[model samples]
Each structure stands twice: as structure tokens, then as C-alpha cells.
Target: MNELQNFDFEGNEVRTVLINGEPYFVGKDVATAIGYQNTRKAIKDHVKTKYMREERIVTPSGTQTMTVISEPGIYQLAGQSKLPTADPFQDWIYEEVLPSIRKHGAYLTDEKIEEALLNPDTIISLATQLKNEREGRLIAEQQVKEFQPKVSYYDKVLSNDALMTISLIAKDYGMSGAGMNKLLHELGVQYRQGGTWLLYAKYQRTGWTHSETKMVPRKDGTEKAVLNTKWTQKGRLGLYELLKTNGYLPLIEMKDESAV
Candidate 1:
């Protein structure tokens, strides 16, 4: 995961992460800052799955999974909001956060550019660099346009939702869902009942997990709705801390340490 960067928007903190060189805003942070009462519902209803991603973010509490949205997703949420601060929030993002992220460094002011233009040697060097960069950007843009349709289709398919199942979460720890469930049970995080894993009583109503009803095909070719529990980003983060405290680390973290 990329390092988390925080930006202030009128006293609200918006966290962002970079994935594959593209910036993504933390969904809950953006939604809350935009004055949404129900942040999760707002994001789910307004943001497309293709524009959202689940990533583990390291915070003061611990490493936790969170949903991050792309720039377009940010616009979509801001555009739909009816709050008074919506317009100002959009302006802040466009005029500050986005430009900062894209530049990834200090930007030259117009006066600085003009000064550089006066120096013949600097002008030649800058012109050559700009020409090469423009050419590279053009080629990349052309390739993206050519493959955009297919890429869009696949992105939609692969990113169906931001929620993650126990099985999916277990993969990070190189364990099966059953194995992870058993471990959590032993660690007093959850308990299995009625062939389903449920959080312990103390952890209930804490937004750590969400129960979703999924349709399961029966042997008779019929389908039945089954209540399935999935880990929320918050839950994933909690789990990371719990597991880490017990001396278990995710595969990625292990790999990072090994490399160091």
C-alpha cells in the first residue's frame, strides 16, 4: 500500500493514497467532509465500484483496510451532495489537493516560469524536457484511449464491491477462511454458531463486520438467501491489529521486511 497523505479541507481531514500512480481519496473521509450523514450509504449509492478500491492503510491505531475512491469518484460524491459546503469542498480539492498530488512536488509559479524563459540555456533545457515529456504523455494517452473500453469492462467486473469476505481477507495472512476463523475464535474475537461465524458479544454493533444476504444455489436448482458475514474496512483493520499483536503478519508486510 502507498503511504497515506492527509490534507485539510476547512477543518476536515481527508486522507488519500496513491495506487498505480493514481490518487484515491479515503471514501469515508470524503463523504464525512462533504456533510453526508450516512457516509457508507452515500458512497455505495453514488460511487461506481470501478472507481473505488479496498486498501490497507497504516494509521495511528494500526493497519486497517479502507475504501478509497478515485478523483472521478470524489467529483461524483461532491456533485450529488446538497450541503452548503459542497461547492467549497470541490473547489478545495480541485484548487489544492489534486494539483498537489499531481505535481508530487513544489510547483513553479508563473513568475518563475517567466524568469526561466529569460535565460537562454534554461529555456533550451526546459524546452527539451517538456518536449520529451509531452511526447511520452501523448503516446500513453493514445494507448489508454485505444484500450479504454476493455479496461473499463474488466475494472467493473473485478471491482464488483468494496466489501471483502473472510476468505478474501484470510489470503493476506496466507491462511484459509476456516483457518482464520478458527484462529479468531481461539483468540476470542469471534465464535461459530449455527454453521456461521459471528463476532463475539463485546464486539457486536461496532461496525467491524457487515452481514450480507447472498443467494446460494441449491442442489434442486433453486436458490436460497443466506446471511453471510463480511469484514468491513474497519473490521479488517481491527483484525490486522489483533493478528499482529499475536505475532502474525500479512504476506505483504513480511515481504517488505524481508526486502529490508
Candidate 2:
């Protein structure tokens, strides 16, 4: 049996155990810490079977069987919680509890420290391992930071389900709508027809552009319905690649000439 460790969260006790070197939390404790009134029900509803298991835990009374959930199960439960303490609970677990468990091996005992201190070689080896691990983590973090802007921009674009007008896409490239239309025409991507811009025959069936009818005021102050073309996210992505291939880039992707 693995050693059972306890952590305090908002005055509640969350018990954890390491199974195969990975931390797993007691389901009841986690549900209570996150303000779930019905712990069993919450765990059943939110956490999947794969992330939870039955474990035998020893208490002051006797050994008892209880449900324990893995780290992913904790996140799954936390994501569905609407309580005010949910975010703080998750933050505490990830930023403090997890790091402490990983670094100190669930909780270091005085006996364990004394054994390590007795061996000079063990201490030196541990120091080297920790140093190498920290260096690797730092390098990975730096790479993630460097790519974060591009990732965020792509995420924003993909998450937006609403269609974009030519003006909106043009604004991203630091060009006016008319300028963008003219550029697309010159590139053979689109053509003007009946006062509306449309994708070429080859591109028409690609689901890139959608046509919507909008009422506009004419010179005689009469309202006339016109077909307005909008671009889908996929279309925008296609256009981005096409423009980049032709030596054009969105303002966000353009590098500073002065810095170069």
C-alpha cells in the first residue's frame, strides 16, 4: 500500500496517495474541497471511470475501501464546478500541492532526510539530477513562450465561429476593404459581378465565402437588397496562406524592418 498523504484546502482535508509514481486524490475529499454537496454523485457525473479506482485506505479505525481519482479526474471535476472557490481550489492544487508532492515525494519524513544525509554520493547525485531537470524545464518554458503569440492568434481565429466581412480581414492586413478587394482581383482569387465581389469558379465550391442578402439605400433614397459576401474561418486561413505565398502577410506576421 502507498503512503496516504493529507493536504489542507479551505480547512478541508484532501487525502492523496501515489500509485505508480503518480498522485491520486481521494474522491470525497476533492469533491468537498470544491464545494460539492453530493460528493459521490459529483464524482460519478464528472469524472470518467478510467480516471478513478477503488483503493483500500487505512484509517484510525481500520482499513476501508474508498474511491480515489487521478489528476485528470480532478481537473474534469473542477471544470464542471460553478462554485466561487472552484478556481482557487484548482490553482492551489496545481501551483502548490502538486509541485510540493513532485519535489518532496508526497511528504518527506525526518527518517528519509537522515538516510539521505548519511550518503554524500546520494546528495551530489540528487543535486545534479535536480539541476538538469530544472534546466530542461526552463528551456521548454522558453520555447512555449516564444510560440505563445502565434498559438493564441490561431486559437482566437479558430474559436470565432462568426463569418468575417472583407473589411475585417482587410483591417488585419492594414489595408482598406477596397484595396483588399482590388488585390484579390489582381491575384485571380476573386472577381466583381453585379457590384459584388465573388470567388473564382475554381474556388466557388470550396465553402470559403458565403453570400448574405443585406438592404442598402440607393441614390434615389430607395432601399435595395444586395448580396454581401463574407469569409469563413477556413476561407480566412486559406487566404492567409495564399497571401503569404505571394509575399504578402498580415500585419501581425510582418517583422519589423527597422529591427532587421
Candidate 3:
């Protein structure tokens, strides 16, 4: 994939490139946007190897190996960023930038099968199957495009430097923890069963969250292993959007960082 997409974050241009059916962002650009004075140093110190990969990207000068960060890597960097605008910038990344790239990137198209079907002896059945496959892909693409939220939905809702717990999110909506779980269920994000937050089946299959094993003391004075469900940056923004749509307004206004 040779496609590139650019978006504005914190009044700076952030460039993303499509590589191998996935979006990889330029590390230097990301670092600069997040207010790091030393781009290479920040990436080397904070970004993990798995999150940061070196790849040859085409540029006006020429193709060169640049450090690129995967989606998860971007979130990790956001968590580590210390700049004042880090939180809001992260919200923009998960809400506006990624969706825009996925919506406009040309790499999502399937490889052409025309060469294989150019033979004179190409069977009618094979041709029909290929045609059906193309039609199915088109339909799926259309469905995805229709399912995405409008551009305005990308606006930042909450501003926090750390991950939000279930209780925190609930408190924002004037609901209890249990009530919040129900709200999450209604939004298809997760459900509560046996006092545990279980990710919905669809999200489980998609690997949208990070789970950790925590030892919790039971009423019987015995420690039991519990799986903690931590909501990612993207997941938090998504829930924020869902709540806003369902009439949940923020009790406190977010900090105004326009001057920054």
C-alpha cells in the first residue's frame, strides 16, 4: 500500500501511511505534534519495538526508512506523552484521524484478479465466483462507511491524562457502577455478569481491549485472580460519543487549551 493521509492535530500536520493493509504513522511527526523537542529521543525512549517499526516511506525527497507507529503504538505514546495537549491530542487521534484514514485510504481495496481471468479458457463458474466476491466486498465496504459516525462526532468530549475506570465514566453520566454497566451493554461495548465486566463477543473477537490479571481479596480473606478490563483510548472516546448521543452531558467543562 502506497497511500498517505494527513490530519491536523493540535494545529500541526500529522502524516500517516498505509502499509500492508494497516496504518502506520510517522514517528517524528507524531513526536513533534505531541510537543517533544527531541523527536528521535522521545521515540527511542518511549515507543516499544513492537509499536515502532522502521519502514521505507516515499517522500518528496525520496524513499527513506522512517520510524512508524502502529495504532496500538500511537495509544502507548499518548499515554506516555507529558505535554499539556497530550490528552486532547490522543482523543483527536482515536476519534478523528484514524476514522478519516480508514474512510479515505485506497489500500482497503482488494487486489485485482483480472490477470487470472484474462485466459480465453476461463470457465464461466470461476468468473461468476470472482464477480460475486467483488460484489460482496463492495457491499461490506458500503456497510462500514454507512455505520461510521459523522465528522462532528470526532470532537473531544473528555480530557484526562490516564485511563478512565468504569466508575469514572458512570459518574460523568450521574449513574452508578451497575447502571454504567447496563449503559455499556446497551451500547454493545461490554456487559456485567457476576460483578465482572465481560467484553461483548464482537469486541472479544476484535481484540479491542487490554486485560490484566489482578489479585483481589475476597470476603473470605482469600485472594482470587480477577481479570481487569481496562478501556483503551479509542474505547473511552467511543463510549463518550455513545453517552452524549443518549443525553449524558458532562457535569464539568473540559479545560480550555486554546492558548496552548
Candidate 4:
């Protein structure tokens, strides 16, 4: 910058000059005091500047290009190179990304780095993930972080006819559909065309008090029902039989003869 300033100006007159496209204030008196000039001369003392110089540096970490520009007492450290070659980010690459890339390509070496960087998928994915993460645009749950504290109700209560259905279940070993139906009827459990109690038992309940059994797949990946049986409801078998015969399982039921 000082070299450019020296190269472009030569005069005894303190000519008004522009730096960085703006006029820089310098007095004819102060100009002489600053050893710039004495009288005002527009031509010979004029100092103009343009795009200056650039450098390509290969550091222990990586390679980067920088640019230089001439301004008042100011200078530009980079020109067209958009990537930063300074600390923080630079250190991260040298200490973090480079190792991963080196391992991916085999070892921490330039050749390995070149090959890893050349891979289109890896480069694009890394760039995109970095951008998204910086902007909080990535879907954190995509890989299932499970960070949120899992919340679930644990205590379970058996319904009035639920145990009755389970009883039918045990009798049939889960096959005797008729005894199931009859027991359902005696219990006033509602049903008609299709038996839903046993199926219901094997599945889950969301709105009512939790079922006695939690529905989960076992280690073999096959789901099985396990009973909790903490609380039980005294069932009305009269209503149970009526509903079982008709397959009318209401939210509430009555076992009284008249109600049936």
C-alpha cells in the first residue's frame, strides 16, 4: 500500500487525493507537515489505485489464497478467496476435519486429503450438513437422538370385563372363541359380529386408564402381551353376558338383570 502510494504520487503541491473512491482530507499545510506536498497540484500529485496483489499459501493445515488492496492507512487481507484461512475455523479443519478425512482416505496425508476432498458425495454432504447445522436447519431427530425425556404412564388398571376376557383367553389357550363369546356375554362385554376383547387385550389402550399389560416387541422382534395387574375392576357378569352376545362393549356397562 505504501509502495503504491509512493509509486503514484510525485509533487511539491498538496494535491487533493481520493483513496478507496473517497476523498481523504489532507491540508496543504498539514500535507507539508506530513511531507506530502506544499501547493495543490491535481495531476502530478494524484494517487489512484486498483486491485493490487494476492498470495497462495500452503500451510501445515491446508491451502488458501489471499488478496491485498491499497487503501488510506488500511489494507485488505483477502481478495476473491471466500474461505477463511485464519484461526478458529482453520484450526478446526487442521485438528478435526483433516483427521476424519485422512482416516477415510487411509492416513493423515496430503494425497489422502486430496482424494477425500475430491469425492463429490462426501464434500457436498459435509458442506451441506455444516451449512444446515450452522443455521439450525438440520433435522436432529433424523438419526433418533432420543434426547427428550421419554414420558409414559406406568401403573395399569384392568377393566370390568377385561379379566373375564383374559379368563376366556386362558380357557381356550386363546382359541376357544365360543367360551370367550359366552364369557363376554355373561360379563356384559359388548360384541356381536367379531370378537374384539381378546384382540383389544393383545393390543393397547390410549385414553382409558392404562391396560394391565404393556404391548412391546420382545427380543426376538415378536410382540407379546405382559400383564401388570396392579388394580382390578369388579365386573358385572350379567351385563357382561348381554353385551358379549350382542357385541356391544360400551364405555360403561350394567350387569343387573333389568339392565341386561
Candidate 5:
């Protein structure tokens, strides 16, 4: 840091006030002040308020004078920064959002829980997800230890080779074709719907397709029922609730090239 010093500018309209080793604008009054102390305070006040706090300042003027920046007014700036921090959003997320998702996550899919945890995404959201994931795993592990797994009607249908045809189930389990369809509908299965599989980005559901069921017809004329569910995001994080809690699907490696 440059210190206040006595200097003569050889009587010019423009003059330099050298502090420690830097030049600070001292206003014409302080630049032509009677002594070093006055010149020093003018420069010190400027350094404290402006360049030092706003950013690092460098001067290439003559003399080895360089002042270590000591700006107290910078405290006001320290209170505000460009980089996102967790301070502001901490209260709502930790107290409200995260806990709410954790409570409701079982009914929700992993994707939806993640969405709630990510809504109004702030640093707190990131922290919540990072930490909540660990707690979530622990919570899930405990839930699994207590879990009672059961197969859905779809699973029962899929597992049957002799009754691969929906028509066969309608003949046997179903009272009528429509009654069988009603049973399937009650259990959330689709018979003949077809459309594009991938939803568009920025979809209304925060990048997730509404949980849906579709029945595809195989070449053998019997419908091969498929549960069309996947997370919109690559990690399939949204579906973790379903995967971990309900035990609907087999565990597979969750891909994360971004972490690499």
C-alpha cells in the first residue's frame, strides 16, 4: 500500500497525489493541501470507499509506492457479492421445502421430489439436494428394511406367459372384455395408446412427463404391456422415490458424466 507523501507537481492543472505507491484522485483541494496528513486522508478515504472495495486497483505511475488496500467501507460491499450463496434462501428451503418433500416423497416419484426440492432453485436447493440425498438414502434404506413389496396387476399380467394376451385375461379373470379393461384401468394400465415417448424440454411438468402407462401390441397379436416410466433428466433422479420405495424396478447404475 502506498502511504501519504509530500510531492510537488511543478504547478500543472492536473496533479497526482501518490499514496503508499499508488496515485489516488485527491481532488484539487487535497492535491494542493498544505501537508502530508491531509493528502493522506483524502487518498485513504477514496481507497476505502471505491476501488479497493469494488475491486483491486493498480497504478503504473512512477515511484515504487504501493499501498496495501485497507478499506473498511468495503464491509458494506462484502455484504453483497456476485457469486450465489446459501444465506438468503436457507430459511425457506431447510425449514419448509426440503422437509415437505421428504414427507411427501413417498407418494411422489423421485423426480417429483427432486423438483420440489429444486423449485425456486437457489443455493439452498443445491445444498438441500446434496445433503438430503444422503439423508434420503438413509431414510430409504430404513424404509426398505420395513418395506413389504407386492406386485402390481401389471406385474402379474407381465409375468404370465400363457395369458400374454389381454384377450385371455378378459376371458378368464375379466367378466367381460370391458370389465377386464375396467380392472386394468383401475390399476392404471393403458391398452392401446401410442405417441412420442420423449416429452419436450421445459415441459409444463418441470421436465417430467406425467406418469403414464401404455400398451404396445407385439407382432404376435398379443399386447405386450410396458410401463413407460423414466426420469426426464439423465440421472433419473426423479424416479428414485419409486425405485427405492416401491421397489417397482430393478436397480441400475445412475449415470453422472457431469460429476466427472
Candidate 6:
């Protein structure tokens, strides 16, 4: 948890904080800003538990547990909003608030990068620092290339929305890579070639699954072609629902009122 800050959104005071190095908005404040009457109802219906977490924060009285949502959770809630200002609110969050938080959060008035940029000595020192950083990064990459991970049957995957891999889907629901593959097979996914998971032809008929070629470096330091399977947004949501109904996701129960 990071320090909580308040900023105005359409004249409404919205609470924002940083969690795990990423910005998150207070769930109750978000619901209020979006014109929802019941914060708990809005959260329970729309937010994924993985994207929401509870933390104790000190207030005027003492301390209280507050629900906070990551950026993804906020957007998910926005999608469920039926208020007249829903679209504009979503746009304001996406186009304005998020960017400002990301940009200004790193601001340091006493040790400013802009001030350094104006001095020749500082410019030379910065260039040297950048070169060292690049070299360190290259060394790290080379080390990783030298030892590709032994594929785990059940392991968490890390990825963003743009291009999701099998590991990404599995990790989302606390499944292993192998477990996800087995679950997919049970769900009628038939083909998986070269570390890529493929949907059944019937599921693919909707054009929800596709493959793209990505370049991977060989042990000999040459690039090779690798086809990666990706799921469309529709496919991802559908798969999530399928898993949800099947009890693959951990049970998400409402917090006890007394506990809060």
C-alpha cells in the first residue's frame, strides 16, 4: 500500500493510491464517482478478486480496511456501469488520470531529471549511467538465453492483455501450465503445437484464436520463428466464464462486515 491521495474527477473527490508499484483507486470512491448507489454491490458483481485487495489504512479515528482495485478492475467495473456518465468517466480515467499518475508519481523536486539535462557534466554522467544500464541489461538477457526454463506442467504465466499465452491464462486462476492444458483438453481444445495452445476447430470458427510468428534467439545467437497462440478479448472472457462455472477459480466470498 502507498500513501492515499485525493484528486478531483468531474468535481468528485476520488481517492487514489499505489499498490505493488502500480496505481489503484479506492473501490468505494470509484463506485460513488460512477454514480453507483451501493459500493459493495458494484464491487461484488463486477470486480475479480485477484484485481481487488483489502488493506488497512489509518484514518482520523484509527484504522480501517478499505477495498482497492487495480487498473484492470477499475476498467472491468466501468464496463458494467450503466450510468449516463459511464463512457466519459471511463475515458477520463483511461486518457487522463492513469497517465498523470504514472508520469507524476516519479516526480522529485529536489533531484530533478530536467535540471540534470541542462548541465553538460550531468549529461555526461547520465550517458555513462545509461550505457552501464544497457550493458547490465544485455548481460541479464544473455544469461536468460543461456538457460531457458524447463517447462513446468503447472506454473504461473505472466503477460499483459495484448498478447496472452497459455501460462498467462493458467496463472490468472492459480492453475499450473500443465493443469491449464489438461483443463483445456477437457474443454475440447485439441491441438497444441510448439508450446502454443490451440482451440478446437469449432471454437476457432468464430475467429477468436489466432497464431502469430515471434522471433526467438537460438542457442547459436540466431533468430528463429515461433508461432504463438493468442486469444481475442471475447475468447478470454468466455474462457474465464467457463473456468469460473467449473469452479476453477478460488471461491470469492464477501468479507465479514465485522472484520472490516
Error of 2 at 256 (Å): 28
The TM-score measured for candidate 2 stands at: 0.44
Best by TM-score: 2
Return the top candidate by lDDT: 2
lDDT of 1 by residue, 78-138 (tens): 7666589877897798778867864623223466478676877856665665565456446
Alpha-carbon RMSD, each predicted model: 16.3, 8.7, 13.4, 30.7, 26.1, 19.9
Q: In candidate 2, which residue ranges exceed 4 Å CA deviation?
A: 105-260
Q: In angstroms, give how far residue 11 of model 5 lies from its true place.
A: 93
Candidate 1 backbone clash number:
1
lDDT ranking from best candidate downward: 2, 1, 3, 6, 5, 4
lDDT of 3 by residue, 9-101 (tens): 757888898775567899988888888899888888767797788887777767788889876666556566657877687778867876665
Better candidate by lDDT, 2 or 5: 2
Residue pairs with backbone atoms closer than 3 Å in model 2 (clashes): none
Q: Give Cα distance to truth, residue 74, candidate 1, Å.
A: 0.6
What local distance difference test score does each model get?
Answer: 0.76, 0.79, 0.65, 0.32, 0.36, 0.65
Backbone clashes counted, model 6: 5
TM per candidate comes to 0.42, 0.44, 0.42, 0.16, 0.16, 0.43
Model 4, residue 225: displacement in angstroms? 25
Error of 2 at 102 (Å): 2.3
Worst 10 residues of 3 by lDDT: 251-260
Q: Which runs in model 5 stand beyond 4 Å of their true positions? A: 1-134, 141-159, 163-176, 182-260
Candidate 3 regions with alpha-carbon error over 4 angstroms:
1-3, 104-260
List model 5 lDDT by residue over 98-187, tens digit each.
Answer: 344445433244665578667756445545655756664466344322321211222333344331323443443324655644544543
TM-score quality measure for candidate 4: 0.16
